[model samples]
Target: MSQLSETTDGHLLKAITDACDGRIIQMPGPMAVTGVYPERSPPFKTIKLKGIEEFLLASARIGNRQPIILKLTPMDAVDYEAIEIESNKITQFEALEKHLVDHLGGYFNLLLGEAGADGLDAPYIASGHSLNAAITIFRREVEPLLARIKATRLAKAEQAAALAYADNDDWGTW
Candidate 1:
């Protein structure tokens, strides 16, 4: 799971930065270019975060002449960096995440409807658009059981509120 998460996080950032057509870089303090990046070269070389920000500012100023791509992976401590690059990029994840969300919402309501009518429990994959809908779907299912999860968390968080405090935690009582 950690590997998958790391891969996804790194891939997503790399994909976003690449699609943005920005240069990826790594630099040290004082704005000194300690590491000269290939400037958007493929198989992008990863580096620190501060450097990616620097490269982004530099690329943006030059009208980006080329596409800008920059990616950052959060590391330990207060310091982490991005695996940077430069290229012609596009926005896809925003749209994909939205689609995935909508699908989940539709099914969430469907599951609620089915569970209410029938007693069989089948599984389905939700993916479409609209994040709120996906959240709504998730809120529909398992949310009732969420109190158990939250209760575990709030066991020492001051006092226990009316169920869990998830902003949208309106799933009645357990």
Candidate 2:
């Protein structure tokens, strides 16, 4: 059981900063921000969170022009536990944490023209391409991954319930 720290937001900030080799920018209130240079150059990437929102907002400029942004939501603790268990079952538990770390790295790559952002709906903030691109990537990539993790979590819960029922000596003693 890892202990949560006040500044790290339950280790989420640490996970992100460590993954990106970025440093946290101190700010007042509940907002947390991390700045990283994927290419170790100008127009770096910034990942921001306001309070304990469900998602983190990330943005960067490609060629120091045209800001690209995306949203990423961390897998819940239960999902992590499920993934850990599944990985252990497959004898790959040792690398499970690394995969989680790689997710941040992958997000950094996405901002560098590694993926396309088009036909993205703009429901908020009519101007500035940030929101649209962010929502697009979130829907196209992040959402499905979240769904898969959720499925794994649900399956784990179901399996545990089934096992408990099986072990109950009076299960059918109605």
Candidate 3:
């Protein structure tokens, strides 16, 4: 398994916000991944986490999904820079981190009836229109897990808690 890092960065926040935005865009069942993506598309370009422009800040539909998948590159290297077109020229930006998070969970509680007291009964995606708003909402949903980590101060505790609460969803086509 890859080593885990305690530091969170803008790129990860961006990815989460993108996934949250997907919650709003595709409302039929599964949520669509959306966020500040490439302002312009280049032919034969590989869609990775790096080489992106943050200035344009456009809502891009990177890929389709049966279930939402949040893929964060890898913040350890601290690489992955985005590019932008400035004054009819190509310029690179280095504001966002390489990787923020890579979480693959269900976001289907939105179409459900009500939420359980555990908070997992509801949808995990945050409702927001802006990037900062998405971040705030995402943080709120994840605060509980963060608090658990801080309180335990042990990887084993955090792992057990996560595993215990792993299956929060109660939906599946039968």
Give candidate 3 regions above 4 Å deviation. 1-4, 7-117, 120-123, 126-128, 150-174
List candidate 1 segments past 4 Å from native.
Answer: 1-92, 117-133, 136-141, 145-174
Identify the superior model by TM-score, candidate 1 or candidate 2. 2
Better of 1 and 2 by lDDT: 1
Residue 1 lDDT in model 2?
Answer: 37
TM-score of each: 0.22, 0.27, 0.26
Give Cα distance to truth, residue 57, candidate 2, Å: 19
Rank by TM-score (best first): 2, 3, 1
Superposed by TM-score, candidate 2 places the C-alpha of residue 152 at a distance from the truth, in angstroms, of 2.0
Per-residue CA lDDT of model 1 for 1-174, tens digit only, reads 244222322323332323333333223333321233344445334333443343332211111343233343223232323333332221223543443344444444443453342335633335542343433335344444334434544564544464355454466544
Q: Residue-wise lDDT of candidate 2 within 16-96, one digit each (tens)?
A: 334432212222224333333344555334444443433222222211122221223243341211100111121222232
User: Which candidate ranks first by lDDT, i.e. highest?
Assistant: 1
lDDT of model 2, residue 76: 30
Residue-by-residue lDDT tens digits, candidate 3, 1-174: 122223223223334345433221111222222222343343223333333322223222222321112333222333332221211111111122111112212221321212222455643543312333333444455434444444545666779877776665654233
Query: CA RMSD for every model?
Result: 16.3, 18.9, 16.3
Better of 1 and 3 by lDDT: 1
